[model samples]
Target: MKRQIVTLPLSLMRVTSIDWDIDWRGAPEAGLTDGNTQVVMNQVPRWVGHLDMTMRDDWLRSWRAHRWQAQGRVGIYRLYMFDPLGFNLQAIVGRAVAETGIPFATGERFSSGSGFSPNVYLEAAAAASAGDTYVTVTCTDADLVPAPGQIMSAGDWPMGVVSVEANGDDTYTLGIQMPLRADMAAGDLVSCMATGLFEVDDDLAGAAPYGKLNRSAFSVSFREVLNR
Candidate 1:
């Protein structure tokens, strides 16, 4: 079923932590007579992980305004999750080293350059299945290829790049950190910094009661919800 995507604005809460559960399954440790474990599977092990986030806030105003659509445990939650490798777009090759006036700054103001931001993305050279770990990137900037270990978002699915290889025909292949969770059609866009769905725990719906007025401290957690 198609789920309503709930995008949270930054005014709601500031992100503190994104702890990914990367404890993937592997061959069983069957002890051998010589004190060694042995097991095997035909298919190469694929990486799978659960995404998590801890957002702290006490803003009753924002929560009350959007709780009907944002808070859930049984439904799918589409959120603009920031990856660890946040905002790795085009390299700011030639720019003045003026620091951004985030939080507080007394010096000069920062300037973001013009034109479309340099993005390392391409149409799928070939279709990929859900369990596939790689896709052929085609017709994009060679100078903007995804680096190894960088996260790339295919629509709402974000996966890391495990490997990169140039096919010599302007089509580069990207090996994903985790196996693809859904099928990709030819010409699908793949890039970094996107949204995905999640599931919150039933018992831990919102916050734990409250303290004094005008201020409260608590964390809201989210678990990645994958498609079947």
Candidate 2:
């Protein structure tokens, strides 16, 4: 399977570390007269792993929004972990939640140059099947139709627009570079970043920036979902 790095937009707080721990529920067998250990295993033992990471409080509003939507409940998400040293990609499918409360932290402000906002959000209108070149996208107030040379990203796959057609009822069919890989359910958020745009830092002059630099960490405990 093609795997890409997972990015939680709200989890951009100070991510200090990613700690992964695994457990194997195996029972050790006792030895007889030799005083040595002997084990008899019929099947593989239960295996599990958890991912823990810390984030500062720089972007607490975004984190709060995420937490509110989650309702402090567990939900399954496709999380990607890349190991550069081993050249391995671990795409985990399991349930996750925010198990800790946000702590108040006083710190320096986070600063960055102004960035362009996305021209339009590519919202999937229906479940898209693989090998379908044309896709239906939600029409926004701008209703901007992508040009042939323009690029759009769905998840991690970036594709150029070959053609576009309005399907009516505030929806359009986009002929992309190729068909999609996995199916995209309706309302999946896809971004079309505004390329070649510049913005001045006019709003940063008098902002107090009450929140601390985002150091709020997110810890998710998950167990691999095994297929029957």
Candidate 3:
């Protein structure tokens, strides 16, 4: 098999958080008739995060806007190293478009240890709760095993096993294995999410915030690949 590496710029990596619509109407409003209240059928924004990953240039170009299907396959791999506090890292495997640069089916296969901090986990969970589906995998520098945050138990906000099929003239099948949880099954739909925040610190003056804090800000990244 031919292999190529694609390095994604830190600006492209992102995490998106969607808000759950508790009520059919947008929000609680007084003096508004039931019919007049606008019902939002979709979720809204809650929080967002940005991340960075390096991959093959060819892979990045091929998956920029194309679509592909994916599925979960069983395999043994080592946990990659990540520095969530140091630098952002993650991994995923699935079928992607050859031309459109869109990923049809995708999910997290592994995550690095440093990538699985409490803040990172919470951010990922929030992304799932909103409506976005997709898991971020962080691979070791050697790419041998599951990285740091490999979910060993169920409670990892696991979505269902996702199967993606391309649309239009595209014909491809992709499967993604995700952390199994109580709220998810084998046929639920989900999207990949990334979130980022900026912080300012006096200790690291003139030092880049790639792994350190510099300012206080949050950003969200979102992409809908497949659902059910």
The most accurate candidate by lDDT is: 1
TM-score of each: 0.61, 0.36, 0.20
**Candidate 2 C-alpha lDDT tens digits along 58-81:** 345544544344333232222232
Clashes of each: 1, 13, 68
Q: Each candidate: RMSD to true structure?
A: 8.0, 17.5, 17.8
Q: How many clashes show up in model 2?
A: 13
Question: Tens digit of lDDT per residue, candidate 3, span 38-106?
Answer: 444424221111223332343333224111111011111111112233223333322121112232245
Weakest 10 consecutive residues, lDDT, candidate 2?
86-95
lDDT of 1 by residue, 9-119 (tens): 433433454544332455666788998778664343322323322332333544544456654654555554444454433233322221111222354322321122123
| Residue-level lDDT for 143 in candidate 1 | 54
Off by over 4 Å in 1: 1-5, 9-13, 21-34, 38-60, 63-67, 84-86, 89-121, 168-170, 205-218
> Which segments of model 3 are wrong by more than 4 Å?
1-59, 65-227
